[model samples]
Target: VQMLWIPFWAAGIVNGVGHYWGYRNFEAQDASTNLSPWGVIIGGEELHNNHHTYPTSAKFSVKPYEFDIGWAYISLMQKVGWATVKKMPPKLQLGAVKPVADEKTLEALIANRYEVMAAYARGVRQACKEEIAALQARHADVSVLTAAKRWLHRDTEKVPAVVLPQLAQVRAAHPSLDKMVAMREELRQLWLNTTQSREQLTADLQAWCRRAEESGVAALREFSLRLRSAQA
Candidate 1:
């Protein structure tokens, strides 16, 4: 009974502490986090973010510095012919390609949309922070900058109604912000436009990459270049 209860208690910590602490490798919408890179006491369950990123992966440790005791145990069991790993998530590989997105690009984007969105958010926040600071410095009454920060990653529908006007003001002041917002929405819509045929989707994705590269924002351009070569 003690053995059973002890395992249950430790597993419970995977949820309670897992979602609230540590750093995230993938920016999943949920609050999931890794409690520790070294999954020592929790049977490698402490790497919750990696687990969420690749749910079917038998090994949770993603970074070079991380350790997965559970995966080590699994390897030992497999060597003894007692265990088998059915599926492991494929890693995304990028290579030089034409300037347009192709089927492989779409596959990679679909598999790693969360990662792209997280990167997009970070880029936007960094850009916006600089813009807001410049605005505040020029105009003492730039209190609306606070609202811009709050509405950083929110889509138009999710942004608070009261803050919409301020957000618009910020966008008007920063052309980069407008481009980032448009690029984000375009990517989201591209993914959701499932009714389009494969050929059409490929064309649309290629067009999206073209626009992203021409957008003049460094992050968007870099992401577009990366997208051109993405493969699952």
Candidate 2:
């Protein structure tokens, strides 16, 4: 809501007081009328009945010499390229227009809007799944490091040759244990950044299962078992 006020306090006071004392300008059977020659300064004061009679007129002042303050502001805004006024079409201007949309049309519009939104949501979910896959791959490499540490602590001299190459690969992939730890932190932050609601998460999980098949299920179950074992 925007409001424009005239500079003069007397104008404002007259606007408030003139409504009851003014002479009727139209035969609308209403008690409203015009107050003064400078009707613009007081924003068409006491002209309710005249407005009811000719609501479509851009100018509220019925008389040629009457001034309209609201029109002055509208002119200023137009000069500054800040406003554009579009007059209503002829039928609507005459108050003869029917409703643009019926119940079924409105329902179809709403359904289409939801369908577009659902497609956008599905795209976001797919992007998140790709990011999660990258995180899981990083987690796998970190798990290898963790396994290497366990083996190292058990007996560093007795470490197997087959596992030695795998340990070296893990070490080469992640220069330090701290790098793997940082990757884990980054993965957690990425998960936190998701805008997915509970319903969206459920949908994403179901989609992921469909895309990844048996490998996805086995990997998730193995990770779950490892987490429980670690907790124990």
Candidate 3:
């Protein structure tokens, strides 16, 4: 269990170093800062103020006193033949010359950005659900009419216009609509197949009962005795 803590500490150091001393590209309202200090051990707990500004960053150490315990453990593990240390991707590592931003400004900016994105996602999902429900209702209406028309004409269109339009709309609104529809259809077919199998099994059981009814009681008794002997 102590070994499990190794990764946590390592991650914390990276986060601390990035936040405390690393440069902030954007002007976050919060003082969440970054450390620019080179080397592993110097990185420590990313200051809370800096994290509030740039929470997504990986490195935490920015100053000399900010010693990262996690990075130290990882280095120890690598030396002891138990672990490997990989450098952060070039995209994640900071440039030496970039300036750190104030903590309060950074925090407000990040918070506002999150709120806007979340609101937009929620709004889109709500609108999609409503549109899909309306389309389904329209499809049900056309299905009823189609059944009635088929009774009179005996020939119906292969695909209904309502279904086609609804499908197109759903596809446009939700990129995963096709996958969802396919999953639903697969589940429906599985249910139908299960029902058919259950019906066949019931019929088979009834037929077996009928055959048993025709068999002599003496034959059943002998079969029971044989079963008991086998178990023994």
lDDT of 1 by residue, 15-42 (tens): 7887777877765556678888898776
Question: For this target, which candidate reaches the highest TM-score against the unseen true structure?
Answer: 1
TM-score of 1: 0.73
Better of 1 and 3 by lDDT: 1
TM-score of every model versus the real structure: 0.73, 0.28, 0.21
- Clash counts for all predictions: 0, 3, 39
CA RMSD, predictions in order: 4.1, 28.4, 26.9
For model 1, give the RMSD to the true fold.
4.1
TM-score of 2: 0.28
Error of 1 at 154 (Å): 6.7
lDDT of each: 0.77, 0.41, 0.37
Output the better candidate (1/2) by TM-score: 1
lDDT of candidate 3 over 143-183, digit per residue (tens): 43233221211111333564556555444544443333332
Question: Which one is best on lDDT?
Answer: 1
